[model samples]
Target chain A: MSSIDIAYIESDANPKVKRWKRLALEPRAVKRERATLLEGLHLLSVVLEHPKAEIAALILSEEAVSEAHELVEKLAERTGARVYGLTKRLYDQISPVENGAGCMCEMAIPAAAAPEDWREADVLYLDGVQDAGNVGTLIRTAVAAGFATIAANVGTASIWSPKVLRAGMGAHLAAHFVENLSPETFREHYRGRIYAADARGGRDLFAAPDYADGPCAWVMGAEGPGVSEAAIAVCDARYYIPIESSVESLNVGAAAAVCLFDARRRRLLKHG
Target chain B: MSSIDIAYIESDANPKVKRWKRLALEPRAVKRERATLLEGLHLLSVVLEHPKAEIAALILSEEAVSEAHELVEKLAERTGARVYGLTKRLYDQISPVENGAGCMCEMAIPAAAAPEDWREADVLYLDGVQDAGNVGTLIRTAVAAGFATIAANVGTASIWSPKVLRAGMGAHLAAHFVENLSPETFREHYRGRIYAADARGGRDLFAAPDYADGPCAWVMGAEGPGVSEAAIAVCDARYYIPIESSVESLNVGAAAAVCLFDARRRRLLKHG
Candidate 1:
């Protein structure tokens, strides 16, 4: 598979192509069996930015090789991974999305280092945020805000799913993720100023306890199911992002961005 | 179709149903539809709060109807929408998402008013963003920030798509939207102000023009392909949301939320 020769695939019937395309079928496909497909130059590069990101293969359309000539070289040269060029028809079959960005990278969500680095960090624990897009966007916000790690529980979508890998737009590289979390496990490993965001919470997130209150860890629940009783129970305090009377709640991803970034503001203020 | 006698679906395989279910296939499908396919009482009720939200129809699993006897009648009476009782086979077919939440509603994205309303009002124009969920969330933010209307140009997804409808939640009731815009049309009828959000803009979105500069517009382009040349050219000013070092851009929706609400903070000062 490591041969640099372009393995052109024109038919949608290609076995690997069909399997790659099927990755888009669910937010976090339990396709635990298949190699996760990564798309777009931005995300693939993001994964490569992280040392732990594993590269199984580089699956790209032949046209992508010709068009993004420079990117193709950098990707192949850096990773030492297999580069297989498929036909456009097969690429579509391998594409998780419709706008087909012309490339896909097969990678593994390689095991993350234990929460050791996170011992002195602020974390985001996601409980069953099943939407892959939301999970991905939150990861982007988390990375941009400088969160070191994010843990997603069993019910939440895997951070490595094709859609999330795409949505994170390579933010996945900026952060580390561990999946298959249970509330107890999250509370057990994460020692920090834990705050749960709920619309009905007593305090506002903006004026939340300073990050100096300890190694802050904010837990957000899924969109509809919000933080579970387990999550709510484990939290040190509950904080809410106040909204104008115009809406009931901000979308979960948007809410997380607002809260997570606000948490970062504390560090920025103290330092700068 | 209006006969309320029996619970029925016109076909074993209907295109719209397939489309609805197709959304469940992709992680972003529901978000892309601009309509979240909400199941159960919680979200359906959350959305039903905003005025003018249309519940296209309702589907109840036969088992669910039996267990929650009052649900069917309650939903039908409250929403003036159709109710269908379905066996597991049909119910499973009708349910596009994994968390079928027992009951579901096909929420509608209300149509926008004519361009006349946007001609001289504070409008938020989406120049090129193609993400349905991003478009929807921005609309929600625009509505919250007190923008009177939203105008989405070509290259943006239809606001009425199910995903936007759901993302905007009930923002359709708060603001208005008009699709397929042209720069000439905007220049001719729009006289107040236009601010294009870009990395290299003329002004800080945090410190925008005064409220006396009422009825302005903020035009946002697709993430990668920022505001169109014509759209950017027409703007009276360009506003940048300052970011920390190492960051390239803020998610369009997040930027909109911050900027629009900052402008909205004016209403308080003006009318205070």
Candidate 2:
């Protein structure tokens, strides 16, 4: 591996080191600074594929410079991004994962304003979905099922948190996100029907009519209390996936996958 | 709350405390000792509903003794189970979660041998799914979709691990589990067709012929190195859930949910 001659930081108290640590660890800092850290080479590569991704810098552990040299060199050349190296100690402190891929990237969080035609497009609205893993998995599912826009209200887990980003598995790069959304604002702007996914006491999903025939939004909520009364009030109807009586309820992520994929399947059959 | 006479242990060095720690922290101890720990009152309540669950003991933090008095006292009375209280410090050391629901129950790990007619029944075969959360979620989904039996090959996560049990959310009590199953043994004994859930290069799941019409097994593999060659060889065909090309793959748990629920939907329609 050829030496890249990149700038290196060793001190824990360095100004840039402190800032990067904050970005990695603090959600408040991530929001206030309007930047986030993407852990590992895989997430870096995925973000690079997006044309609008504003990659600010690439940071690597000293070991990664030698181990993942080829991909690092290629990524640096393609994006002309500034590169920095840190001692393993500093890298480990900042990384959410221990002994992770040993590479990290800093980039602006993707925030696309709800489009003028957003009301006529399909959307997935997260209502107080608190778990980072569930929030991330839901975003990944929405994108794969062809929901281009995701709206998360105030009580939901922060989309760009390190844990959520790790769980998202690079789906953040492929989709547009709207955060701190309010159900009231959604009701005002979105013209299509809004459906809440209930844990129980709703129309059976398969037996329900195809609401995917037009612009629509699926409101998924937290597991225990389920969709808030306020969120449910904004919906046109509530639908539930059927399961055996013995099982209490499906995990929120699993429920979202079933609802979204079933909609996609029906839409595909209808259009074909 | 009336004072319930119960044995209290303050010392961490006690044999029961040491053993409980092993069961909570070590998979080997759980497997060898044939016992597992369930965290929280909700899980304990769910297990109590299962008629066959043998409640060996109930342990509560001093805080829970007052906070959850009625339920704890009733549980002790109902099963005539041994009840013990641990100092908060001692309880925290033995529990998997921090500031968790303070009540815990110990029970024999459910291990029902595959039935005599297992070959004629539908099953979910987990092929080397290593993530504890994924393993637990898949089991929950399997039971909800009415798949009575779950078979996991040796490489998969232990179904009774604390993480798996928490993620399974008491689904383990409702479903039968067969662990350390070999693919060769499965191939020999199970007469039903086996379909693997492939990430790519397979017939479209929606367009594929209705295999759910008969007894079958769905082999779901790990996220990266999908179904092993040995396991794939045992399958009759593979079916890929059609997804947008931009996303790499669905999380294994999500993939399993889609496949199992689709089968359930078809079967429900066929009979109805």
Candidate 3:
């Protein structure tokens, strides 16, 4: 193991502190640097488990180091990552959660493959779903349902944003993510049957027996506008989750959970 | 219709403003007054549609009045609700959403039915589900799935709170809500097959063909602790949603969606 020499940062104005704050708050900075910030111990632990995860820096508050000295030390030893300690006040400035775990990691963003290079995978395509929490919950739901990949179009929330990351609850580590793709590019490059989720004018999802035992993609639209005309045109079929007419529609996140898990249920019944 | 005399309040210290603020922010005030605040145009429209809805006061920003004069006038005419206008600054203080709809309503909290008084109804029992957003989402999901009643234990978030009201997206209008009931009382009074949602040690929900075509209750627990032992003990059975082993579990709201919709799907199939 490399010699343990931890740098201590005391000021919010420090360059490292500035960079961390930018990464936590600004999506552009994350994209520009090709790095994302993982906050709290749960996310850090998940990132560590991934074989491709590359830790650029490991930052801990003084309190975090005091509270979890052994775990922090072991992580640093295992990854040989450069470690930095921040004063409590400085740490609070960069922490996104109200009661943060006081540990954060700056890690390289995972590379995305071109549509042409996409492998046979169960993919979730998010089109214009802008709510960060919804996006994150969908990602978590996707992972739980055994989806292998997530591809989000331009209007969707950045998958690496801090809000989405927190909502994802470490599910990002288990799935491949591709972002900022256009509908045209996605259709041209992806080699899968695409099913669009629509509220009206679609077959009942529960009764639809056409979900083949092969690679497929489920395209979800934005909260209100739903999938664009262009995106809808490329889909192989449209499916709707039945609901009571008294309510207008289900929340996108809830809708995603029902659909994704239903697909999983079908697969298990067919394969098992 | 009574002559429209919209009283305008400019000062934050005004009694009406103080009361609205209290109703919006303080749970104790809401419970004491047996009233809750509804914000925005969509909620107001939904509340207006309920024949039993009693609007004690209607508060709108001057901008809202100007922007939606016809709708506001119609609501006042229909409900005969006393209308008050607030300065933009005063309205912003009480508005929960970032883009305040500039309208608010103070309405009676719907009376809850005793467990014995509940008719043949599909019920959702929430035990210690404290997150406001989660509580609201579950209520919406329940309504969409044709559940007729919601019973939340003491530790659950207040069903009438502003945050929950907003997240519910008008589902509250269609469902009877009971709160502060203990597991013992709930079991003694409720008449339905009780199924607890468990992450482990339960029949596969998708494969469980035993869901009788009758009134049933799905008991969901808090985000972290899952269902309490007391709650679980009273349940007739436990059902689990099958998911991948890589992730820990689905979010409570998401889990509710999958389970509730599955029940609905089954009912539709049986009846269709």
Instruction: Write down the RMSD of all candidates, one decimal each.
Output: 6.3, 1.5, 2.3
How much does each candidate deviate at the interface, measured as C-alpha RMSD after superposition? 3.3, 0.7, 0.8
- In model 2, which regions exceed 4 Å deviation? A65-67, B65-67, B115-117
Top lDDT: which candidate number? 2
TM, chain A, every candidate: 0.87, 0.96, 0.94
Q: Write out the backbone clash pairs for model 2.
A: none
Number of the top-ranking candidate, with DockQ as the measure: 2
How many residue pairs in model 2 have overlapping backbones?
Answer: 0
Cα lDDT computed for each candidate against the true fold: 0.68, 0.86, 0.84
lDDT tens digits by residue: candidate 1, A142-195:
666666588877888777777777777776666766777677877777767677
Per-residue accuracy of model 3 over A112-183 as CA lDDT, tens digit each: 865554546888899999999899899999999988599998889889888888899889888888888877
True contacts kept of 3: 0.77
Worst 10 residues of 1 chain B by lDDT: B1-10
The most accurate candidate by TM-score is: 2
Query: Can you tell me the DockQ of model 1?
Result: 0.21
Deviation from native of the Cα of residue A141 in model 3, angstroms: 0.3
